[model samples]
Target: MRLDKFLKVSRLIKRRTLAKEVSDAGRVTINGRVAKPSSEVKVGDILEIGFGAKMLRAEILELKETVKAEEAKNLYRIVE
Candidate 1:
């Protein structure tokens, strides 16, 4: 899945556009490197997102085109 779509589908970011914008602005990183909106997302990949004063890090658990709200949390694992 695309990074932006993965972010939205996984409920990490609220919207795909916002995710793309932030990613393009260099706020999103994959394996500690800046990632683009079109970056490919795969299982076990580490993702880090910078949001103002907050930073979110997660490990991709699964990649699905669509997911229910209840199942969204199953897509990734949070990492401190």
Candidate 2:
């Protein structure tokens, strides 16, 4: 899955466009390197997203084309 799509499908970001913008602006990273919207996302990959005044890090647990809101949380696991 693409970084932007995963972010949206996983409910980490509110929308796909927002996720793309965030990724393009270097606010998103994969494995400690800056990432783009088109970056590939796979199981076990580490993702770090920067939001104003805060940062979110998560590990991809699964990749799905679509997921319900209630099940979105199952797609990734938070990392400290």
Candidate 3:
């Protein structure tokens, strides 16, 4: 899945556009390297997102085109 779509579907950023903007600004990384909004996201990939002064890291656990709000959290697992 596309990074932006994955972020939204996983409820990480709430919206696809916002996720795209964040990724475009270089505030997101995949496997420790800067990633673009159109970057491909696959299972087991590590994603680090910067939100203001805070940072969130997660490992992709699965990929889906759409998921219920209650199940979104299953798409990724938080990492330290």
Candidate 4:
């Protein structure tokens, strides 16, 4: 799955376009390297997102094309 799509489906960013914009602006990284919105996301990959004064990190667990709201959290594991 694409990084941006994964973010939206995972409910990390809420919207695909916002995720893409943030990614394009270099506010997101994969495995500690800057990643584009089109970047491929696979299971076990680490993602870090900078949200100005705050940051978020997560480990990809599953990558499905679509998931229910109740199942969204199952897609990734929050990392401290």
Top candidate on lDDT is: 3
Model 2: number of backbone collisions: 0
In model 3, the runs with Cα more than 4 Å from the true position are none
* Pairs that clash in candidate 2: none
**Cα RMSD (Å) between model 4 and the true structure?**
0.6
Against the unseen true structure, what C-alpha lDDT does each candidate score? 0.96, 0.95, 0.97, 0.95
lDDT of residue 10 for candidate 1: 97
Residues 9-71, model 4: lDDT tens digits: 999999999999999999999999999999998999999999998999999999999999999
Consecutive 10-residue window with the lowest summed lDDT within model 2:
48-57
lDDT of 1 by residue, 1-80 (tens): 89999999999998999999999999999999999999998999999999998999999999999999999999999999
Residue-by-residue lDDT tens digits, candidate 2, 1-80: 89999999999999999999999999999999999999998999999999998999999999999989999999999999
Over 4 Å off, model 1: none
1-80, model 3: which lDDT tens digit per residue? 89999999999999999999999999999999999999999999999999999999999999999999999999999998
> What's the TM-score of each model vs. the native?
0.97, 0.97, 0.98, 0.97
Clashing pairs in 3: none
Clashes of 3: 0
- Residue 10 error for model 4, in Å? 0.6
Superposed Cα deviation of residue 56, candidate 2 (Å): 0.5
- Score candidate 3 by lDDT: 0.97
